[model samples]
Target: MVLEKLSKLIAEHKDVDPAGITLETTLESLGLDSLEVVEIIMEFEEETGVAIEVNEKLKTVGDVVKLIGECE
Candidate 1:
């Protein structure tokens, strides 16, 4: 469920196809800059009620999923 929502959010924000997004997809590969990443993180936090700290560790979609899972 988290992956689905996150993928949709990323696809909408980046104007890409959600079907193309995967756990291994890197944020940089999607052309997401630091500010864009932060914005997405904030949006996800609000939606999921999971506070995510912006850091170097959040490089891939899987990373974010894992963090959200851990938080929950």
Candidate 2:
């Protein structure tokens, strides 16, 4: 679900290698700039029914996965 969500998010932007992203890749590193955080959060809310407060503290993709798993 996470990868699907992430790939969809990236597809909304530019080309992304669905296989390129790994658990260790930070969303920021994938080019989801800080400004796109809100969009990503909203997508997660819709896709997983999770509400997240995005901030600099959310420093990695793992943080997002953990947060979504926590929602519920």
Candidate 3:
């Protein structure tokens, strides 16, 4: 489920290398601009049945994983 959700967001960039997207991959390195990141968070909420607030706090990919884990 996480892969599917992430792939949806990752698919936006042609240069995004799949192998580089580990749990530790940063959003900036993944080419996720602020708007794309918000869309990703929204997609995750819809996909995983989790509600995430759009705040300035979550600034990394690890932050996203932590938020999803908290939902679980």
Q: Considering every candidate listed, which one attains the maximal lDDT? A: 1
Q: lDDT per prediction?
A: 0.85, 0.69, 0.68
Cα lDDT of candidate 1 equals 0.85
After superposition, the stretches of candidate 1 with alpha carbons farther than 4 Å from their true spots are: none
Better of 2 and 3 by TM-score: 2
- The Cα error of candidate 3 at residue 61, in Å, is 1.4
* Model 1 alpha-carbon miss at residue 40, Å: 0.7
Give the backbone clash total of model 3: 0
TM-score of each: 0.86, 0.71, 0.68
TM-score of 3: 0.68
TM-score of 1: 0.86
- Per-candidate Cα RMSD to the true structure, in Å, reads 1.3, 2.0, 2.5
lDDT for each residue of candidate 1 in 1-72, tens digit (9 for 90 to 100)? 988988988988999998898999998899987788778778989987887766677888898788778877
